[model samples]
Target: MTSHPVRPVADLFAADGRLKAIPRRPARREALLAHLAETLFEAGRTYREAEVNEALTSVHEDFPALRRYLVVGGFLARTKDGAAYRRQQRPTGTGGAIPAVA
Candidate 1:
């Protein structure tokens, strides 16, 4: 598959890692959210819903939306009962750069 090009996260987020605004382009949005997901979660680890929310809250005030973006962007996996969450082994994203924000 030809990977979609992505702009730097600075083009999307504020200095604090909060999304300044959602990108209109799907490719850029997915790339930016996928980068955000990796920063908030770790490989080989699982999280409870509350834990995921707490972590996402540090990055954005609208944690639920952020969580949905992460899952929908194929960067995170969640259980059907919504009890568990984890970074997926292989995100079906365009494989873009990880953001530099903390």
Candidate 2:
């Protein structure tokens, strides 16, 4: 199986592990959103808006933007009423390894 390229998280965070700032580049921002979604939430667990805010704020002060990005990036799904959120499953690659070429 081929593995996906992992985005580097080292430069995006400070010594305390808080994000230095929300990334302006789309790729970088998407990586950040995925990291936040995976680390801050559990799959199949529903979180209220306040709970999400609290978890996000522990890492960065701008919780709203992070929340919006997570939803927009399809990393986190929200209820129609905007009352709850869940972490979507990480996308998988191809089911099996490719055969080696001679």
Candidate 3:
């Protein structure tokens, strides 16, 4: 349930479905990041740190940064112990852009 109605930035990706660059604009980046987040996870599914990283690896070799984007962009939530991650359930029209931290 995204306010965005669509990803809105398909041009940011390459033919292989990997991002060409991380957008500097939050709106564009967050939208694309949201799409990337979904590919790495399923709704209501919980993943281990390694599992999350493995999934993100499909998009970027810098999996850690991608993971951080998902977390910071409010697409995923992580435990303090850093063992698990979960896809967030956001309210429709909220745009899923709330940062998990600050």
Q: What is the C-alpha lDDT of each candidate?
A: 0.73, 0.78, 0.76
What TM-score does prediction 3 earn? 0.76
Q: Which candidate would rank higher by TM-score, 1 or 2?
A: 2
**Could you tell which candidate, 2 or 3, scores higher by lDDT?**
2
The numbered model that scores best in TM-score is 2
**Per-model root-mean-square deviation over C-alphas:** 7.2, 10.0, 5.4
Whole-model lDDT, candidate 2? 0.78
**Candidate 1, residue 56: CA error in Å?**
1.2
What is the C-alpha lDDT profile of model 2 across 16-73, one tens digit per residue? 9898999887768877887888888998888888999999998899999888877766
Best by lDDT: 2
Model 2 lDDT at residue 17: 85
lDDT of 1 by residue, 1-102 (tens): 788666687777777667777777777877777677778888878789999999978766888887887776667778777888878755344354331111
Estimate the TM-score for candidate 2.
0.79
Mark the regions of model 3 whose C-alpha exceeds 4 Å error after superposition: 1-7, 91-102
**Residue-level lDDT for 21 in candidate 2:** 93
Report the C-alpha lDDT of model 3 over 12-80, residue by residue, as the tens digit: 878998878877767787787778777668987778999999888877788888888787667888877
Kindly report which residue pairs in candidate 3 clash with one another: none
Report the Cα lDDT for candidate 1. 0.73
Order the candidate numbers by TM-score, best to worst: 2, 3, 1
RMSD of 1: 7.2
